[model samples]
Target chain A: MSKAVIPGMIARKTGHIINIGSTAGKEVYPKGNVYCASKYAVDALTKGMRIDLLPHGIKVTQIAPGMAETEFRSVRFGGDGPVRHRFTKVWTRCGRRTSPNWCTM
Target chain B: MRGRRAQAVEVRGLIDGLMVVRLAERGRQVKPEDQQQQRKGTHDPQMCWLACELTASGEQEVAWSTGPHAKVAFLCPMPKLILITGATSGFGEATARRFAAEGHRVIITGRRKERLEALRSELEGMHGKVEARRSFILFTSTCATMPLCKRSFPPTGMERDRCAGEQCGPRRRAGPDPGRPSRGLGAHAGHQLKACCT
Candidate 1:
């Protein structure tokens, strides 16, 4: 993706790049060692890209979404039941403890 | 009986855009117009759209599925040009395949040039009706770790940086001698991701 944009960047001398990140990048999850590390790398890349490309009038942004209903969890856990239960229990417990009102369940 | 009752209430909410007033019991002096005004002040149009969809679908029973605003907006009139990395397998490959099937001009990239070539041939053969000019697959050695590789492309007329860094993953510290190009494990992974996006 970046390679495709390079030619344009050289031509216009400016550009912007947006990368999708996840909360997993900001905080580590159990058994998510490599994936977490990868997301962290994305965060670092966003910062670096911003600095390196800023002079050329390029902007870099990173969006780290939390608990989005994407295919991520199903794929990560290899199925829906076990991993979903575990994650829901953990997040629900955390939500209840942190903000009971917000934790409707 | 309990589930049936809940379903009836949910159906009512759907017909009324999930208004809190509609959920209130009979003769409950709830002013729905006021509540609607208050919600409109805080919620955006996309949120309103999502709320309507979820309530209509009866998924509102799930606590996590409370507001329509939680949904991601689907891009209409799909983009003509799309670039995907990690196109050799998994989500990237699936997405590239889907978009190409939808008749969009798609460019898929991956470090495994052979895999990309195979996919390209397969998609082209399958999508004979769609012009070959609309789809392409490119192979690149660099992965997600190296952004500089893509920085080399000539800028087309499109906005150069409208959504930069939004979809890119995190970065790691450059290994010693940044100038020296080394294909380590990290670089390989980086290349894989970059390949999909290209």
Candidate 2:
């Protein structure tokens, strides 16, 4: 996405790029190691893309949302299974503690 | 401690949303109207729909039991308008319910028309006044992707790249062209509204 937009950035000479990274990029969870690594890559990409495109007057940014209420829970917890139930309990109990002010979706 | 924690939570939430919008804006996937709608809190159909899903999926049962502390923890100030994608279920649905209850205009989108209709009816019944201008629902598979397609304006077959690092992340296929005009490159560049509100 960043690459495709580079042209637009160059053409505009003043563009903004916002990367939707994740908290996983900043810190790894026990079960979410790979996901975290990908996010880290995103973090790196944001910096690299920003610096590379800075000459064109483009601004780069990254957003790393954590524990947002979305389909992520269902996907992670195992869709209508016991894992779902247990994870839901843990999520409801611990989500606010870990993520603080989280939003849905 | 509790009050401080709540304040921290609120800040984080705002930051997260802002971050996403900033990222989207930087990426150029967002349109000016979309940004304006987002600022009004009526953009990002996925989030609104997720809220509705959470509400309908028996989560409302937990809302009361979660207690005042939890309420404070989860309480989000209503935006003037909200756009949600993937709103058929889960977080999107729950968000829609919450926003409507709080008297915000909401636009929802998803692949499922039935669910969207149901949600519209449900929200109207609950709010007593259907927010026609604020409430909208669309059927699109790539609804979350850039440049929302309204009923009157169909997509122009231009697929904006995915966010920076998704599975099929945007590939830099187009090389830098020195000859391209430097001004007015963005389709919606001059529009007063910026893209994707936080």
Write model 2 residue lDDT over B60-176, tens digit each, in one string.
211111122322112233224345666777556766666554445565767778888887776655433223334454455563423332211111122233221121222233323
lDDT of 1 by residue, A38-97 (tens): 999999989877766665566788867665324565677666778777776787677532
Fraction of native Cα contacts kept in each candidate?
Answer: 0.27, 0.11
Model 2 chain B worst lDDT window (10 residues):
B4-13
Candidate 2 per-residue C-alpha lDDT over A3-57 given as tens digits, one digit per residue, 9 for 90 to 100:
3334444543555665667888998889777888899999999987776666667
lDDT of 1 by residue, B1-198 (tens): 333221122121111122221222322222323234434224455444443344334322111113433322211233345566767764556656555544456667777788889888776654443443354646565555245334222232223222222222121223233454433223443444355345
How high is the lDDT of residue A8 in model 1? 45
User: What is the clash count for each candidate, in the order shown?
Assistant: 54, 43
Judge the docking of candidate 1 as incorrect, acceptable, medium or high.
incorrect
